[model samples]
Target: MEINFKGKRALVTGASKGIGRDLVIQLVKCGAEVVAVARSRELLENLKKEVPSIEIVPLDISDWKKTKEALNKQGPIDLLVNNAGLAILGPLTEVSEENVDELFSINVKSIINISQWMAKQLISRKAPGSIVNVSSQASMAGLENHSVYCATKGAVDAFTRAACTELGPHGIRINAVNPTVIMTAMGKIGWSDPKVAAPMMAKIPLKRFGEVHEVVDAILYLLSDKASMINGVCLPIDGGFTAT
Candidate 1:
């Protein structure tokens, strides 16, 4: 059966660019009323010009009080994609405490704070919806210089599982999508060198890093009722790389 969300309202964080931006576009096409959240007001304004009907909320998700305020003002939404994240890679021993705090604030804490507010909204309204957290393959395996990012994402997946258990009875499902070497604009720059990408690609059965749409598609599935029975799972969209 085909997936559809014609009248659903979706709140997508990190929506200014990359997979988040593309996801917003796709959701709009699928007829969902999208509330796009990100820190880039210019980019969001541009996106609004393209999709005039979309709602835009530009705020840093790292600030707990402000993030909570923004979400509370958003009224109600049917789905949430926690895609905002940051990575400051270096050797584990050399990583700064500041970096660790920053990464955790955005990549980890943001999800919990936002989801908590969403949970209250859902529970109060007695509504049912889905939440998709955009995690990374780094969460599953160790990568050089990615120590902090990995830890944060790992924590995110753990929270997804635990949150699913508590929120499931409330009819709010939560899951995480772990992608590998995606081909977003930022990704292209990070993986631009064949020397850098070749080795990572070799580990994947598909022999290629993933494209943004592949991830977008996976997230859309999990967000839709098509994945109604799928909850509390950390789905690896890694081109079978994790199979190795």
Candidate 2:
């Protein structure tokens, strides 16, 4: 079935750049009213310049209280894309406690807070909606220097499943899209040197890095009516990286 988001209101976190930006553009293109959230006002402004139809909300997801207040002011959101996250790469032994806490707070806890808020609002209104958490393939396997990041995404995967079970009866579906490294600005920074890129590319059967639209396409499908029966599962858009 052809996917369309006409009459839907979507809120996308981390929408200033990378996969989040692509998602906002795609959602708007498909006729959805989008509220784009990001911490960077400059980047958000630039995004609006590119796509004037987007409604920009500049706020950090790490600030739970402020995020909740901001979201409460927005009325009802039909789709919540919890895509804000960070990766502070380092061996577990060397990673500071503060960094570990930040990783969990931003990557895991914020998702729960936002999803909970959105789910409650939608359920109270008896609105049918979707929640898509942007997780990582790192949640599926361990990697050197990625222990804490992995743990946070693992929590996200589990939370998505558990949240779906509770919210499904209320007509609110929750799912996650776990992707391997995509060629975004953050990905470029991580793979700037051939030494880093070679090993990463070798692992993927696709042999090349993923494109932003590829990930956004999967997200769009999950958010659309096309995935009406799909819920509580993490779909890996990793180009077979997790398979091998």
Candidate 3:
């Protein structure tokens, strides 16, 4: 199905690279005015060059005070994609307080903060809106050395549900997308070794990692009016990995 976002406005965090960057481009192609947020002004500037009409908001979404101010300045947004996250992998035995704090600050705290900001805007305006939080399969499955990352994503999924409960009454829908390893730069490097990838690959019915567009397609559908009835669902785009 062809989904359109004409006359809508979207705010996508982590818009500098990987799935976030591509999502920004696709949202624009679907005719939505977009505000792309990321830490790297230089990279965001380059993205602006490619998609000239998109507005860029350069900030670290983990900064609670500044994030609120930055998002408030955006006026009104019709769609929100809380795609910014950090993954610091380590075993439970090796995890440190600093690592845990940083991961939760970026991955969990940022999502809650931004989603609240977006929901308020939509609620105050009495506008119906959609929010897609970019969570991960790690939230549901246990990986060998991703204890902290998994914890953060788990929190994200729980928060998505809770937020939906409150926001649904305000005509705001909130959901999450948990994707398997996609072939982004980070995915290619982390899973490059056959030994590392084989165990995970064996579990997937499709026996392959996901591509960027596959996840993006799922997200776009959730963000559009096509998924109006879908709320508080943590949809997995894991090539049937979760199924196995």
How many pairs of residues collide in model 1? 0
Error of 3 at 236 (Å): 0.8
lDDT of 1: 0.93
TM-score, cand. 3 vs. native? 0.98
lDDT of 3 by residue, 1-244 (tens): 9999999999999999999999999999999999999999999999999999999999988799999999888889999999998988877899999999999999999998998889878988999999999999998999889988998999999999998899999889999999999999889999999999999999999999999999899999999999999999999999887777
Ranking by lDDT: 3, 1, 2
Off by over 4 Å in 1: none
lDDT of 3: 0.94
Off by over 4 Å in 3: none
Q: What lDDT tens digits, residue by residue, belong to model 2 across residues 158-204?
A: 99999998999998989999998888987888778999888988998
Clashes of 3: 0
Pitting candidate 1 against candidate 2, the one with the higher lDDT is 1
- Per-prediction TM-score to the true structure, in the order listed: 0.98, 0.97, 0.98
Between which residue pairs do clashes occur in model 2?
none
Please list the residue runs of candidate 2 whose C-alpha ends up more than 4 Å from where it truly belongs after superposition. none
